[model samples]
Target: MATITSASLPRPATRGEAKLFAEFRAFWRAFVAKAFNPYRPELHYMRGPGPAWRAKHVGLSPAVQSMLAEIRTGKARRSSPSA
Candidate 1:
């Protein structure tokens, strides 16, 4: 580690230096907001893996939905009453 000394420290800032520092800070804030940020679109519904996986299976055909409902009610009907 480097040793710290009083002589290595920066001199106190004058009024002009202080004003320039403030202006640079303001410019950086505005610049980063427009240029350095990622583009994230808004989602009206749930996001991420769980929601995505659930959504894929949740959209079932009418026939499939009816079959599922019947199975749940202990009345699953096999087409043609297989032998």
Candidate 2:
């Protein structure tokens, strides 16, 4: 499982402030994609595996993290594979 360092945590946004948060999340996701995706033709179409792996390993929140870990590690309550 991936570790959750403070540096990886996104800055907290207010309850209704969507603009900055949305942009930040988008930027973060893009950054993650570029970082994890292999810079080649074959892996080009497999962008989602990074996000899926993230959702399964380094989730956005603790609850999500736990759920993702369960799915990734295939515990008793394994979640169905996501497309």
Candidate 3:
């Protein structure tokens, strides 16, 4: 086995080098956090209905379609009985 020498050993970093390393570490951490972010807005968002839904609902009657349109447009009032 070869003997370990002082010259071959790793030296302690100076204050400036330590500060630079810390800054680099912080920057790398932030970069990784942003790059590997798990929160996907598109995945969680509601995109209304898809083509399959539209195809399935294509046979809706005109009266039902009109009622749905009214409800969607907020023109259909609640038919609650007055107390």
Candidate 4:
């Protein structure tokens, strides 16, 4: 078996090398965080009716239009039979 020697052991990093390593480590951590992020803004956003939907549902029946208007005016209420 070969004898271990102090000279053959790894030397401690110098100040500059330590700083560079710290910066690189920080950069790598940030890159990994961004790469693995799961919070998609598009998925969380509240999507409204698009132009195609508007085009497809161009004509609303009078009852539905009145109900929608009531909802828009905050006058629509849930109907529950009185106990």
On lDDT, the candidate that comes out on top is 3
Cα TM-score per model? 0.34, 0.28, 0.41, 0.46
Residue 77, candidate 4: Cα error in Å is 31
- Over 1-83, each residue of candidate 3 has an lDDT whose tens digit, in order, gives 99976666689999999999999999999999999999989889987899899988878889999999989766434565446
Task: Write one digit per residue (lDDT tens) for candidate 2, span 1-83.
Answer: 99876656788778668887888899999999998986778755754556667768873878878888777788533565566
User: Candidate 4, residue 28: CA error in Å?
Assistant: 0.7
Q: What is the lDDT of residue 18 in candidate 1?
A: 99
TM-score of 2: 0.28
Off by over 4 Å in 1: 1-8, 37-83
Show model 4 residue runs off by greater than 4 Å.
Answer: 1-7, 47-83
**Model 1 Cα displacement at 27 (Å)?**
0.2
Cα lDDT listed for each candidate: 0.79, 0.77, 0.87, 0.86
Question: Model 1, range 1-83, lDDT digits (tens) per residue?
Answer: 99977766788999999999999999999999978667755544545569768778778889999998888766545444657
lDDT, candidate 3, equals 0.87
- Show where candidate 3 strays beyond 4 Å: 1-7, 42-83
Query: CA lDDT of 28 in candidate 1?
Result: 94
